[model samples]
Target: MTVTSSERTLLDSIDAQEIVSLTTSLIDAGGENPGDTEEATAKVLAEHCRALGFDVRTVEVAPGRPNVFVSIGSAERPGVLFVGHSDVVPAGTGWTTDPFSAVVRDGRIVGRGACDMKGGLAAVVAAMAAVHRAGLADEHPMTLACLVDEEDTGLGIRAFVAESEQRNYTCCVVAEPTDLVTIVGCRGAANIEVEVRGRSAHAGQPRNGANAISAAARIIGIIEGSQAELDANPDPDLGPATWNVGTIAGGTGTSMVADRCVLAVDRRLLPGESAAGVVGDLRSRIESAELTGSGIDVDITISMEMPGFLTSVNHGLVTTAVQSVIDARFIPNGRSAGSTPAPNGRFAGSTPAEFTDIWTASCDGGFVAQQMGIDTVVLGPGEIENQAHRPDESLAVQQLTDSARAYALIATRIAALPGL
Candidate 1:
């Protein structure tokens, strides 16, 4: 396939308002699973893909886990992959309107997945529509893949990368809530559970028994105490990796020194940090603690984890995204027709090529970048602060439009990919 300016123009000509509606509707509908908001979203995205006249396929990896894939060009062609999860995190409680109801207020769209993702999904649809409207389909091929299970676990992407043998592509764009910044890399995390064993005894003679809760507290001390070491050495982009003692459970009753204590930990990691290294170090820390006569026991198990990944800013995806953003925001050191101060339709820098980019923390980007060997760029609409997940989670109208434009341009540039 060849490239043409008319196709880019067509993609650029997409209606931003419609894109917002499309996204809002999906958010309002919500998905079924923790990641796949609704199975309908898969069908909706498939329709969008088909409407653009692309060859689309849906892979139901698990019982209800549905992943959609559409290729605009042949697999042999150099292409760009736009990857996003069709699923949205669950809407827990509290809301100005129904969490699934697309409420447009003060020019903003509000819903559960409004900012966390649906915003990006809608923009993807608009971008697809643009390629068709602009006739870009005739020149280049781009793959828009929407997967399920990015929220609960990255099973969808994990499955796609594992199940699909012919997935080699040039680069990838993930529509996460990064406020349209080009996020290159970020920290990974480990979700672990620790259990402490002990003997049971009556409160009157507690000294004769082992107190699991007490032993667990000592473990907490070791874990929390280790934070100083983690904080002291921070990654440039992701900053200092931190550990949080999230939950604790132990003992049978107040009157007895009952056995069994459990603690849930959330550990965030930076670049150069490995799970084995972190877990081993933590285990060593626990072992090194003197608990000879404490009458307590301990054990730990990994619950979940996502790895950290980075891409070079010099990579074609990174350079093109940054250049596109600079051109959209700063005066081209000059002026152009219809050029005025509007929302900067550009992505900030952090993803794609692992160069000098600053990603704030861990996300699904970790899975695509590290697990699947796909260079992931975190770029999307809305501020990271506002994805409040309740009490009216929202995405600014302008943010949606801007992100849609950025995705459109990035998709175009990616379709015209360079050697990976």
Candidate 2:
């Protein structure tokens, strides 16, 4: 299938109504209950794959959660992966609708995961479909890796790479919502829990026992001081790393002298830094602190290790995607479409018209870039600010349709590259 400029325009002219219906259907896929939303989400995706004549399969990676993999191009050409997560961040408090219910109001698909990722997922599939309708699969290979559990953790993507080593792909395009920015790099994420212990003391007796809060005071100092080191090593484009004592618990209500304290530490790592090393540093800080003398103990454990991703601007994937975005948004390409900002205020203006910067957030692309060692970039539709884990997350109808067009253009060029 040869995709010419005419083919690009043809796919770009996707039915807005069809996109809204798909969005509503996808939003209704109530797989967010700690269960595999994959079944419902995959059902929608599988139908698209089948209609487009691609090989589709849902591999059960977990008990109820499954990872969906679809391939549209033949094995003869170089394989490129398009990874997207079907799961969304849990809907928070105060939603107007049943979070799962995709309501159409104000010209947007409103629901959980509509912006953070479900929107991206729908757009990617539509892009794939557009590629098929334009008959461009004959020249290039495109694979969609829709995994589960990206909202709670990135293990879904990790499991996919570990389980499926069957096909080797040279590039991965993760459809993470970046508004319109070209994200070439990301900061690593580290989740650590620190604990402290002390003998309970009566409120009336001042010297009877040690105060756990007092013991924790030293621990806090050590952790806070570590910020300098975090900042000492800076990450390009994204400034120096940072750490936060996000959560702290001690004392049983306000009436008693706390005997135990726990610290939940959040550390954002810069490039060239390892998640393990960051944990070790925090551990060393805890041990080196003066809390040990006061019967206070420190425990540091890494709950999550999300590695950062970055490829040179010159990488074929980056070069291609950035050019694709610029052409679609600014250059004389077929990307001059109009879209309104999400319900929340995360976007600037209604449509994309410039080379926006990458967002500071975690995405499955982080794992693919680090785990798969594939040149990756996070590009997609919808404004990100109002969409991520918000009470009201929604994507404009036009944004969904236009993002599909942009992605299709990129896929066509990728598949038709001289040698894969």
Candidate 1 lDDT over 1-420, as tens digits, reads 122455345534867678876887677567845544457777776776687677889889787667888776556665667778777767776776888888888988888788878888787767666765666654555677788887666777777767746556667787777766677778888888888888999999999899888888888888878998878877665678888999998787899996888998988877557766788887788878865346776777886777777777667777766545434333222443133332234223343332124665567777677766777777777766657355688888877776666666666666545565
Can you tell me which runs of candidate 1 are displaced by over 4 Å?
1-8, 32-37, 290-295, 326-357, 415-418
lDDT of every model, 2 decimals:
0.71, 0.70
Stretches off by above 4 angstroms in model 2 are 1-13, 33-38, 204-210, 253-257, 329-356, 415-420
TM-score of each: 0.86, 0.86
Q: After superposition, how far is residue 66 of candidate 1 from its true place, in Å?
A: 0.7
Give per-residue CA lDDT, model 2, range 1-420, as digits (tens).
Answer: 233567547565566676677777778886673555667886887786787688887888777677888887776666668888778766769888888888989888888878867777777777777667767665656788888887666668878877745466767877877775667777777787777777776788736766777767777787678777657867657777788888888887565677888888877766567778877876666666545755556666778877777766655666566556544443234333243232223343522323435447767777777766677877777767757678888887767776776677677666545433
Reference-based TM-score, model 2:
0.86
